[model samples]
Target: MNDVTTDHADPRTVRLLVALYPARYRAAHGEDICATFAEATAGRPRSAVLRECRDLATHALRLRLRIGPTDPAGRVLAGAAPVALALAAGCAGYFLLPQLRELVHRIRYPYPGLGLGHAVLDATLQTAYTVPWLLALGIAALGRWRSARIAGGAAALLSVGVLALTGLYPYTAGQMATMALVGALVLLAPAGLVDVTRRGRWEMVGLALAVALPMIAVDRYGAQHLLLPVLALLPIWLSAVAAPALLGRLSGGRPDRLRAAGVGLGALPWLMPLAAVAAFDRPARLHTLLQYAGACVAPLGAAVAVAGAVHLARRVRTTDPADPA
Candidate 1:
């Protein structure tokens, strides 16, 4: 077997890979790990060398987290605020732009048959659609946690009132339950802006309801068309729920708990439509099945990606600073 010495190994490549670790970590153990790699990969195939590099990278991350300055909870908290803000921005854009366009249309093309009061009511509803997200985005961006909390709370109450009046007034058991869950999620989300606690997690049961009760209500009502409004507002509902959980997780809450929240919340927007369809009790078409299947799967995929990103962020933030690069 050829004994490849440190000089014989590719220093540049090894250094490049080592750079993936935290600067302080690399400063402390980079040369030693590289030497170990050179010795281990002597007379090995290219696949073996690649495998060793992967292992090294994994070890580096483990060490970085283990020896880093911030604790797990602290790292999570710090990262969560930004995540919340981003989610708020995305939701605002998704739900707001369409309303803005409609508002413009209303201005340009007034309805001839509509009464003045009705027209004013229509305009008020349109404004309601856009205002909560705008408030959330602004307050969250400004780091005004208290104001954001108030905005979220107000939005939740307003959403319930609107839904009850227009969508499900004289509410059935299922609708009542669904709205309760939405309210809980909205109320608890602000907690994520600072930190997540055991109590906050208990409150997140709303997430489960957010996913399940909508379908149950649709089935009970035998109204397939009801799925449209539910699905349309789902992104906003999810953003409201997820922003806080992400904030809590990034701030220092348990990742497992946060990941579970993410999975449940993420699954709802896409899966609710399918669940509504299933409630229809009709024959399933192949194309429809495929479409719903994709919808159901997309959120799960996104949940996994989000979980991985959170983990990576945790590791990156926890690096030791004493060691020089």
Candidate 2:
């Protein structure tokens, strides 16, 4: 057995790896971990040391995201998973529904302005936006972390493809990229959260339906053709308004600021299709776009402000030490 305190060992790198462990775990096993890491990497080539660090980082992430997650940051990411999934699916559905309605009516491209090439582009856009994210979330819930990461990576790339397909509108493209970002976050989440229950899947599906069907209903039943954009987005508007208060109630106190922030972050992707509808999506109306945009921004803005305030206070408490009773 080689001595771990060898001079060739990179003590600083080893210490940083050890610090990635959960606080309690670090307190109990940190020295042993550092010793083992040091012993393994002493006099090793840079590439080998880098590989070792990567493996250790994965293990640390698993510990944080595993059943009964203990790390606060880990808990926040895991808690945010369901919320992100819902938002992503809802946005995808909102965009995909009109196309689906047209297909059902046997009108692939009713307008002379929308060519077959454009129809194919729209289908590809929806597939790229939606499928990989669903795959990433489902695979993670099933405890297949490697596959989840692959799916998440694919989701991110496909989302970029969706942006390119959109012809590069910065505001809408940035909004569209939110699912990619959410997918990236889930790439690190634990396997089999909530024992791999079906709850999360059903919730996402339900929200997607909730967002899409209402618009179709209003158009078909109430004869509110001009209000389709607003109807399509109304559920999201309500969610933005309701989520902060709902998170506060569920938290039973000072509000889960991190979770609220996550929900607000999740809401952003909806703006992509909303902007598209206002600017170019069929039934594009100048009249309601302002209302649509404001509905998207206001509640999310308030939630972000609160989250920022909480973060600033915590930073002050931690870094200032000026508290006086």
Q: Which candidate is the best by lDDT?
A: 2
- Per-candidate Cα RMSD to the true structure, in Å, reads 23.0, 11.2
**lDDT per residue as tens, model 1, 1-325:** 3443223447787887788788887888878878888898776766677778866765565455542213443333333332333333344345455466666676567688775566667767756644674575456445555566567556546645655566532223233334334333333342434433444333333343343344335434645555555544454345444544444443453554544453344324333334444444366554665565555455445545666777788778787465666
On residues 1-325, what C-alpha lDDT tens digit does candidate 2 reach at each position? 2432334556777788777888988899988888788778777776677778987887776775552355555555555555555555555555565666664343454447776766665566667777776666566556555676667667777777777766767555655555566665555544344223465455445554555566456545665545455645554554664356434523443665554554554555556555655666445465676676776677666655665676677767789866599
Off by over 4 Å in 2: 1-31, 34-55, 59-69, 97-122, 137-150, 188-201, 215-235, 238-261, 268-294, 297-325
Q: State how far residue 316 of model 2 sits from its true place (Å).
A: 33
- Supply every candidate's count of residue pairs whose N, Cα or C atoms clash at under 3 angstroms: 6, 0
Show model 1 residue runs off by greater than 4 Å: 1-92, 104-109, 169-183, 189-270, 280-294, 302-325
Name the weakest run of 10 consecutive residues (lDDT summed) in model 1.
168-177
Worst 10 residues of 2 by lDDT: 188-197
